[model samples]
Target chain A: MIELIQHLINGFSMGSIYALIALGYTMVFGILQLINFAHGDVYMVGAFTGFYAIHFFKLAEHPSWLSLALTLVVAMIGSGCLGWCIERLAYRPLRKSPRINVLITAVGVSLFLEFAGQLFFGADPKFFPQVLSFEGDWSFNELKINPLQVLIFVVSIFLMLALDWMIYRTRLGRAMRATSFNLEYASLMGIPTDQVISLTFVLGSTLAGAAGVLVGLTYPKIDPLMGVLPGLKAFVAAVLGGIGNVRGAVLGALILGLSEEFLVGYGAPTFRDALAFGLLIMILLFKPTGLLGLKRAEKV
Target chain B: MTPSTKIKLNYQSSILWGIALTLVWISQSAWIGLMNPYYLSIIIYAGINIILAVSLNLVNGFTGQFSMGHAGFMSVGGYFSAYITTHYFAQSLDSLSQIQQALIFLGSLLAGGCAAALVGYCVGLPSLRLKGDYLAIVTLGFGEIIRVVVLNLDSVGGARGLPNIPGLCSFGWVYTWVLICTFVIWRIIRSSYGREFLAVREDEIAAEAMGVNTTQVKVKAFVIGAFFAGVAGGLFAHTLRYLNPQTFDFNRSVEIIIMVVLGGMGSITGSILAAIFLTTLRELLRPLQEWTQIDFRMVIYSLLLILMMLLRPQGLMGTREITSFFRNRRGDPR
Candidate 1:
């Protein structure tokens, strides 16, 4: 029972990170209807940014809540700017082209970023600075909870809630939704669809950036290719939740995280990726629209 | 020309083509027999790539399904063929006659292709339903899953990779398969059934409304593409004499896709040309790695892809074949 509970806690923390990344994927997909293959690399970029920010600012020397928050903010802003630039430079011109063309471009951009990251950061893994460490775990009877896990859970939930409020209550969110619904109609209504699209990228990437830092905090190791597997799993989560549905992305991510944790905990660890990817194939086969996706009749 | 006369001419031309191909094969073999190992290796690689690119064009270009899992099929073929040769036929190679060795190679290659085709058929059944980007993701998932499975299989040396397979692939085999793949794809595309594939590519719903079974066409394209990919994989395994799960990852699939896209998606001749050009370019760029800290080749390749999409998205040949160029030169606008 304790083991199960511990696995649940681990799953929840991991799932929250996935949910954060999935939110970005779902949001960008909602607006552009283009699967940003580079979104995962953006997560890697964010993590890299955080890693640099900590060292540049010498936050590790005096690791505190303030330094950690500062580092995260810098990373988020850096990633947000990168997201906007990628959209403008790589994706904007191909807006009128075929989806496959845009998709290929996305892939190219992803490869470029990954390789570029490897070039710049070196191919080796780095230890993420322990910025959010504590003395001991909070234990209740036989159950234990690490402070880092709590911090990850708390930070991710806060970001998600902030995203929800922004989407539901803000004017920018309204523009984003309108643009996603009908680009032409939204533009005709004087909504700057281009800016809205950029904003969507920025917002999504910021969340992913935060997730990157959080992941680094929990795992404490970062590398150039760290985002590939998690990014893919998050993509599966986004699809499982329904491509454009925010809440569905979160739900799907939690489920994926739980299943992954359980599989590794109980099942053979080698088959973990197979299980996750197999679920993607199964979902695509059975419910092309995804769990929360609304089926629209094909209009003649 | 009268239909009867035209049919007779086509039969004569096909016979002449057969003789021409045989002559070309003999001459090329003799030529390769005297060449240095380096250039021969490049040519062989290019030939295998030609097979891969052309086969992929059948699916992504003509059939209009975005399959990002071509490398997975290729890996399946490679691993399967390598396993079979090493486990079942490794001992017989030294004692066997030339004819027997040739037969074993043929059987293993066929076995490899058939295995890949079976997997392709199963993958296609569920995947062909999804359109555009969704299908791309599913295929990507399948490719990654294959890699992960192959990585975990201890019998195939696991992540360390399988090595010491018999070096069965020769330039002769590669070129022959390349010709066969190209001829088969070309024949299929020019046939009436090929028109159905083009129709599906143009618009799936319209094609379906026009009494074409879109699903069936998709499956057909996928299976044929996969079969050739497997053949290419078998060729790759035997020639390289090493097989790793990582070798057939998504990057490899993207490389194949790049060849197809760069060559001109629906143009067989374009695929051939692009495969040659890109493979040559990669080889030429191999020496530039010392000047840079990173793989500038891929960096340049990715940038070129983005620039190409922005500039000339239809690729080098677009939909026009080499024959079309000749026709245009003769004042026949098509």
Candidate 2:
């Protein structure tokens, strides 16, 4: 029972990070209907930004909540700018082209980011600086929890709640929702769909950046290629949660995280990656619209 | 000239050309034996890539099914055929006559292709119901799952990779398969059934409404494409003399897709040209990498892909054949 609870906690923390990434995927997909393949690399960029910020700010020498907050803010802003740039440069011109063309371009951008990242950052893995070290686990009987994990959970939840509030309560969020619903109609209503799309990318990438930093804090090893698997798994989470639906993305991410944790904890560890894809295939097969996705009839 | 007579004359000439090509291929051992081994290997690799790109174009280009899992099928063929040769014919390979060895290699290649086709059929059956990006994601998932499974299989050397496979594939075998794959796909594209594939690509609902059995046509395209991909994989394994799971990853699939797209999707000759160009370009990048001490090949390739999509989304050939140009010159506009 204690082991199960322990796994659950681990899953929740991991799932939160996935939620952050999935939110980006879901939001971008909602607005543009294009899978921002580079979004994963943006997350990597965010992690690297955080890494540089830590070093530049001497955060490790002066560990505090302020330093951590500063690092997160820098990463988020950097990634958000990157997301905006990618939208303007790579995707905007292809908006009138075929979806396949846009998709291929997105892939190109993704490859460019990954390889360029390797060129710029070097291929070797770097140990993320421990900015806030809580050198022990909180033990409750046989169950134990790391303070970093708690921090990850708390920060992710707080971000998600902020996202929810922004989407539901703000005028920009209303514009974003309207644009996603119908681009032409939204533009007709003077919504500045282009700006809305740009904002969507920015918002999504900011969350992914936050997730990247949180993941670095938890895992401590950051590399250029680190985002590939997690990015894919998070995309799967987005799909599972019913892509384009914010709440669905979060729900789907938590489910994926929980299932993956259980699989790794109990099942063969080698099959962990496969399990995500397998779950994706199964979900796609049984529920094409996803758990919370609405079914839309095809119009000729 | 009457259409029937034109087709007959074309068919007869094609047969003669096939015979001539066969004779040239038969005599290739004499000439290819003397060529620089380095250049020969690149040519062979280019041929294998042509097979991959052309086969992929059949599904992605003509049929408009975005399958990002061609590498998975190729890996299946590679591992399966490599296992057969290593386990079964390792001892008696040298003792066998030349013809007998060739026959065994051919058999194994066929077996590998059949295995991949079967896998493709299984994957395509349920997944084909989905459209566009959904289908792409499912296929990508299946591909990743296959790679993960292959990585876990200890019998196939696990993550260490299966090594020491016989180098039975040659330039002749590769070109022959390339020609065969290209010819077969071309025929399919030109045939009445091929029209169904185009119809589905143009609009699935319209094709279905026309009673075009869209699902069956898609499954067929997938199976055929997988078969050729398998053949290419077998050739790759034999020529490379190794089978690594990493070799057939998503990047490899993207490389093949790039060939199809850059050449113009649905254009067989374009695929062939793009495959050769890209393969040669990659080889050329080796020296540049040595000079710069940076792996700029993928960076350049990605930039090319992006620029191509941005500037020329229709690709080089844009669904038209090289023959169309010649025909137009002859005052017969296709």
Candidate 3:
């Protein structure tokens, strides 16, 4: 029972990261109804930004909460700008184009970022600098928890709560909801639809950036392509949670992470990655609308 | 025109086609027979890419189904073909006559294609029900799953990969198969079945309303596309004399998609031209890496794709054929 608890806790930590990323996917999909294939690269950019920030600011020498906060702020802002630019540049022109055309452009952006990253950073993986060294652990009756896991859980929850408040309570949030509900109607009502879309990208990219830094801190290894797997899994999570539902994204991510953990624990570890994708296929087959999705009547 | 003149024109056109095909076959054979190994390798790769791009175009362009897991089918074909060739004829092929070796090669390629087609059908059945982005995600997942599964299986060398498979794919084999693939696909698209596939692409609900079995048409396209992809994979495997699951990763699928998209989706001639151009461009850019400090070819390619989508998403030829370009030049109304 204790071992199971331990595994569950581990899964929850990973799930939190996925949930954070899935929120970005869900939000963009909600407003645009287009899958942003380059969202994963944004996560990667966040990690790299945080990485460079730490190195440039010499935060490791100070090893304080303020420095960590500073690094995260820089990463978030940097990633947010990138997200905005991606929207304004690659996607805006294709607004009136076909969905598949936009999707392909998104993929092109993704490939551009991945290869550019490889070219700029080299293909070798970088070791993320640990700004805060938390060596402490909590253990009870064969159940143990590391400080890193606690940090990850605490940070992700706090950010998610802030996001929830921003989405539900802010004026921008209302505008976003209106825009997603109906862009033309929202625009007719004097809401700045384009700005709302841009804001959505900024908010979503900010969260993904935070997750990226948190993942680097916990895992301590970063690469240009590190976001690809997590990005894909989070996409699956978003789909599982009915895509546009924020709360459903969290629930779905938790399930995905837990299932992956259990599969790794019990099944052949070699099949670990495959298990998540296999689950995606199975869920898609059974519930095309996803777990929390409501089917809309098609107009013939 | 008179009936007699029409008959004469038909004979003339067929003769021209025959002459072109013969010249192509003879030239390919001569190149393989005489060219340096380095240049020969490039031509072979171009042929494989042509097959992949054209086959994928059948699904993505003609049927309007977004399939990003084409490399999965390729890997299946590669691994299966290599397995049969290595296990059954490893020793026998060494001392066999040239004709016997050619026969065994053909058999293996066919087996590989059949296996891939079967897998494609199974995957298509459930996944093809979805449209657009959902279908893309499912296919992407399937591709990744295939890669991971292949990585774990040890008998076919697992992560280490299969090496020293017999070199059965030559310039002749590649050219011949490329010819066959193009001919078959061209025929299918020009036939009534091709119209059904196009109907599905235009609008599925409308197609269904018109009594087209959209599901059956999609499955057929998926299967046929996979078969050609598998044959390409088999050719690739034999030409390289090695098989690695890693070779058919998402990047490979994307590369093929790039060709299809850049060539003008749904245009076979465009795919063929784009494949050859992109393959040659990649080779030509090899020296740029040495001269500069970075390899920017992929960067250029990605930018080109984005720019293409932003400016002209229809691609190089759009839906028009090469023959149409010439006909237009000859004063035919476009």
- Which model scores highest in lDDT? 2
- Candidate that scores best on DockQ: 1
| CA shift of A291, model 2, Å | 0.7
Q: Estimate each model's TM-score.
A: 0.96, 0.97, 0.95
lDDT values for all models: 0.88, 0.89, 0.87
Q: Which parts of model 2 have CA positions greater than 4 angstroms off? A: A296-300, B16-20
Better of 1 and 2 by DockQ: 1
10 residues in a row with least lDDT, candidate 1 chain A? A291-300
Which portions of model 1 show Cα errors greater than 4 Å? A296-300, B1-20, B291-293
Global CA lDDT of candidate 3, please?
A: 0.87
Candidate 3 per-residue lDDT over residues B165-204, each given as its tens digit: 9998888788778877887787778666689999999999
Which candidate wins on TM-score? Answer: 2
Better of 2 and 3 by DockQ: 2
Query: Quick one: ranking by TM-score, best first?
Result: 2, 1, 3
Task: Give the Å error, residue B155, model 2.
Answer: 1.7
The candidate 3 chain B region of ten consecutive residues with least summed lDDT is: B1-10
Q: How many residue pairs clash (N, CA or C atoms closer than 3 angstroms) in each of the candidate models, in the order given?
A: 0, 0, 0
State each model's TM-score restricted to chain B: 0.95, 0.96, 0.92
